[model samples]
Target: MWLSNSSCEEVVVSAWGSGSEIGVEGDILRKVEKRVKELGQWEKDVFGNVKSELSRLRKEIAKEERIAMGDKNTRYFHSCATKRFRKNSMEGIRDEGGVWRTSQEDIGEVMVNYYKSLYTSTDRRVSTGILDFVSTLIDEEMNESLCREFEASEVASALQQMAPLEEPSPDGMPPLFYQHFWSTVNNDVTSPILSWLNSEGLNGLIKKAELQGEIHGYSLCRRGPKLTHLLFADDSFIFCKATMEECDNVLEILKKYEEASGQKMNRSKTSLFFSKAIPEEVKHEIKAALGVPEILHYEKYLGLPSLLGRGKKESFDYIKEKVWRKLQGWEAKLLSQVGREVLIKAVIQAIPTYTMRCFKLLASLCNEIEALIKRFWWGQRGDRRKVHWVKWEEMTKSKTIGGMGFQDLAMFNDSLLAKQAWRLLNNKTSLFYKVFKARFFPNSSLLEAADSRMGSYAWKSILRGRDIIQRGAIWRVGSGEKINIWQQLWLPRKHPTIPLICPLESFENHTVDSLIDPSTRTWNEQLVDGLFVEEDAMLIKKIPFSRNVAEDTLYWPYSTSGNYTCKFGYRFFKEEEELQLNAQTPPICHKHVWKEVWQMQAPPKIKKIFFGEHARMYFQQNMH
Candidate 1:
């Protein structure tokens, strides 16, 4: 029952039937193949039943009974036992004296001594002056948040945040085990964690320091928000001027925090980055004062460059290498076309997605990535090229149309970058937005801000994304003061939201507010009708005003929610390209025909064949 006949038949039939158009099979041979699929399904069913019975037996055995059964009695237990010992074994340990100890006794003694030293505390004294420098950053609201009771959801989320296949816990269960069996273990796991959190309990101290003028933070521009510290989970980045006083203050704050919170800093892991302007002697002095080594550049933080320099391609070449490694392990020759399609979309395409969300990759690099995917799709390996039957551009079109629903990497990257830009457009309260706004456009809004030659690579990339938003986004009327009636696209209509009638010289600078009655906070019908043509006037009058007369804001009309999404943004560009292409070339298939092909009762694999063959025949007969 685990492997049903109908389900297995569908998968096998689809894989086998994909090439049925190229060669014809007789009714008897088709019947025999159908029987073979059924047999394969039945064989899988038999195996599933046996596996189920074995699992039941293993579960029913008590802890004592399992130990008595021994490794020799069950291959499953034997494998688990062997793997545990092999992976967990300690071969040797190097002592502090730089000698490698091979014996078990020496290794145990070394471990004990190391942990003893690690846990042991040294006498420390804090001057009253240092304590005075530390301000009261935690308020009543923050204190309450720290002291609040824990929820079951928080417990589950913490466990889920851990890597699924990471090393096993003390109980020999990896995170994957708990995640897989969460439903069964939920109450048991939740109760203990909640109890501990309720018993024990839990700011940006650097910001308060900056406010008190005890410390200073680096800024990109004079007007921008100063960059003091960045914190995400356990990672922290601290910025301050290169001075002994500043360094002492920072160290004191950290010491005070550690003493109060019982959480110790990993000094070995902490690193200091100094600007080139700082003198070499001063750098060394600060490093000694802070008790952390100085580094020219960080290796990586959260799997991304902490600071991107002039060499952008070199900085991001790792993405290309990662994609290549993924392709190397996959056997294109063994996988079905459908299987390949799934892997390419889900795995390969997803590899660059995280990086793309933060940076706009070079177009050449995007093309190179797409080339690797194209080769794999056509069964290419190790410099052996396969003839590409269709253009990559055609392949990226929607499945409901004539092509596979593959992403166009370049457009997809822009779409992702546009999403970041959209966030800045809307989330003005975010730290990122505030910092960028101060640095790049202190006086102007993101929409009206122009690209500058002096801008950083990230700033420039965001501006490129802004181009897409500008094309699709229109003003959602609120107060109507910000939207110009003749110039801006404010009317909620399918086409030509702006005025069709040319504006008279007298009314050239009129805003939407000119047509709004101030008393009623509604459209002045007489003014609207006089200014625009009937269609434009009708659309303008239909737009409802906010009850409270809210400020005018930008919105994308293509989406029902009116908010920008990467999916909708990417699709909008692709659809626009299709529209332009259709305008130039004669149509091969009607909209209703393609709709029917997609809506057919046939399986998707067969439906693809139907569309492919029809398109091929149509092109051969007409375009050729």
Candidate 2:
């Protein structure tokens, strides 16, 4: 039933189609062959010409789009889509379709038409391969011709006229000039010299002979008795001081290298500066034979400006500032990678290690981070008000106290110098200490001497802090008294209290007889098993006494306690009952000192001590 209904309801529509047969008729179709010949001639003449026009049209369209959208906002989607559609359509045209039959004559005409259209098509691939090759060949030939023309022209003469006058030479002597000097030497001359030296065991000898300081980069070679310095990359300076005849032998080696590498030394810049310190007979012989100058200096000289000059100071400052800026930039980049919380914490932690440079770098990092965060997260807020504060404490706190532990670079610098005292004392033979001593205090002990010339307010301040520790606590161990080993090693000679120690160097060295007798072992073991009295009590009791101890007796809190037995050892005090009974004394402070002493004996488990309400509040505000 459905099939019958569909068949009876057919509708028909007709319209004129643009087919060759319909449009031309049979008579016109015969004329089409003659027209095709004319069209082929027109296409061949116009194909390459129209390509430029097509490109111009595309550029104009693109310019209009750019003006409308702004260059940054312009989208590639439309251009890409148009290109893809054109490619698909052209591909379809290439394959046989309903309008075109693939006969031999028909295929030939179709291909010819396709080729003609391709030269001017919007698709660039059509022209790229062949055009690129032809363009490259043309450019090469043009370049060659241009180079020849330039060589024959007056350009070199004109350039010389424009150049500044040559720098004045002493005695009106014309300075020697070398052309393509560094390039020729670097490629042709230096490589073989390096290779020859690397083959011999005397490479170091070659490097020593060059001795051109830091400015004049040079290469060298040494083979057997021969040594050559490749000066300014092209010229060779050859000499051997091993024997009188070796000097001539060195020249022969230089000649061989020059021949092999196709480079000749400029004899004009090849004068030698001979040492005047050599024996008079040797110097006379060398000068007479070689005609070398006796300049009293054998080493290459650097042309650094005198430090007394303003220009030299400015130059030094500029270099230092540039280095600081570069370091700050690196720090800024690193801070950007870190989260705000971590960066803030690090800054706070670093404050304790204060130095002026570190402070400046941290401040710069903070400012940079603040600016970037404001730009990104609070754009409108930043625009309205230029200043932003993540927290007031970050800006207000002294670098030493806990707030935002950013280092006080000035203090940190002093601390670093102070630390050097330890190395000076402990490693007197170290090359660095030896050099420092030679430069600043040649006649003084590195351990005891502070350079009066170099000492500043900052250095003095660090020394003052160090002096405090040197004069401070004395430990009582059993019946003997001693001080920390570091105190003896590095404490300034002028320190108020000199450290004293028992004959035993360390606690481990003390025998059972030295502590309590072996007879008391059972009682000591029972005491140790019952309670954890730290071994620090025994160690502290052994420390030597100081006159300052008597003067500061009131300040010595633990000294009030009389002798009392604990798990680790016996603690002897002046009045033991006073310590047991004094509840008003700060338990937290006592616990801190107790733990410090305990760790000296053996590592102790730390117990957190709670502070009073007032103390806690004070610490919280100050810490932040």
Candidate 3:
């Protein structure tokens, strides 16, 4: 039978018999038969004895299946259905251990395709400028070489005698000899050589290049026999990839560009990083270019240590420590000169919007300053008493608070660090964490345990302050009872029949169960009762005809008789005269026994709490 029912008994039997009829192999069919028999026995022996258990298990399985299907649908909707749903579900998936995977090869293919399309779409003529320039230079060089070859035999005798002329000056030389030599040599030289001599001219072409706007600045220079490659700021990667002769040829071209540009090369910024041993002639040329006593194996420039040895980590540490020490010294000097205020401001400027630690440090430093001020100037101050009582909020507030507004570094640092939470949530793939892995914590971890170096005293102090704040005092206003909609202010139609007040000592201890349970009482029941007494009983001096209670005895409805009424004073009375008489003499108004009236005028203590000197001052200050 092809059972359509989804029940376990029916599905299992159908799957087993269907397997038997499919002409499956003997072993497979036997295994299926054995499993079916076992399942049938289990149904008869285990399930039949526990009737409700089977039904409950079925219900549970169905519920779980429904949930699984719903979750699968949610994932599919996010990935293929809508962009908004995809964004919303991404966080949920990540939290649920789901990871999106893409192949590096696929990424590379996409990048290559995009570049190829871009190149193909471009105009050929516009893209041929570089090739054309290189070709023209090569043609000129070839022409010069051919000309030199043609004139070599004729010029041999003249060049032979000219070599021994010693100290031949351009101005002092005989006119005929000078003209013949200059014309032969200048005309025979390759264009690359001519360009190099004209532009670089041996002095350095960095200045020329800068003047021509070809380079922002000269980065490096390495000399070669008859030429030098002066690296401009525009060139990120420049290295000799050919033999010594080819290198020299390339250097000649580079020199020509440099000489024409008028920018001087910075030999200090340059170095030769060869995979194989360099030629002696090339080394000599490089020495001449750099003017150093000798070429060192390694050197550092712009705070980056050159990678020449295996001690890369050590080298980095050496440079980093030196820089950090120097910064610290500078900070100390700045602190001394400008005082803590300007020093803190400078630190803040350096860190700006990057970390909350900066602000916390500022706040901590302020606390330190306050402590110091109190120790040194408290007793000696004119307004000593007043200064001690000054609230931190008031002290940090603007002049309107009767004190100068100064930054509280502790609070500032906590708030700043708190921003990191937002940053991490937003930028999951920033390189800052990658570069300084130890400085930042991994996701889903607390900041306190992160392996951040306490590089600065201010930063350490800020962290300490943050720890204290995490453990500091917390006050809550509400009964442990969960309020319904009527009790909430936003739900205007929903007002609590009676307001429930509870003080939460520990935030973590508060829960929905504790809030919903009305019977749960707090240690400070009197305080809660004072704030939320039934409206009807608020003005009642006593319950009439009750011998067990005195005239001024107070009773909450639940604590009193079971038949007692619960109402507020305002809702209880319909007339002002009745309210006044009831307040003056309760128990005389029997007709309005269900109601109690409170005088519109509040009691002395209530007046003190609401309209006393402090309250009046607060009201007047905020009146505008």
Task: Write the residue-wise lDDT of candidate 2 on 1-624 in tens digits.
Answer: 111233211210011112235232222222333433443445445454555788999999988976665443123656766887867542112322333222233345577776787776675555556766664455877887765522312422343354233663322211211111222112322334344433332334445434532122212212112224434333344444524565554554455545433344444445554333557777667666554554322222222211222232332233234333433443433333223324334443243233321112234444443344333321223235542322432322222221222323333333344344434443455554555556545665543446364543333433433332232323232222232332442222211234434433454333222332244322244432222234533433333332221211101112222111121011111112224456543446655654444234221122112112223455577679
lDDT of 3 by residue, 299-331 (tens): 553333444344434433443243334344443
Clashes of 3: 39
Best by TM-score: 1
Worst 10 residues of 2 by lDDT: 8-17
TM-score of 1: 0.64
Best by lDDT: 1
Better of 1 and 3 by TM-score: 1
For model 1, the run of ten residues with the poorest summed lDDT: 22-31
Regions more than 4 Å wrong, model 1: 1-214, 255-269, 288-298, 495-501, 584-608, 611-623
Candidate 3, residue 188: the lDDT equals 25
Q: List the residue pairs that clash in candidate 1.
A: none
Q: What's the true lDDT of residue 446 in model 3?
A: 29
What is residue 329's positional error in candidate 3, in angstroms? 22
Arranged by lDDT, best first: 1, 3, 2
Would you estimate the TM-scores of all the predictions? 0.64, 0.26, 0.22
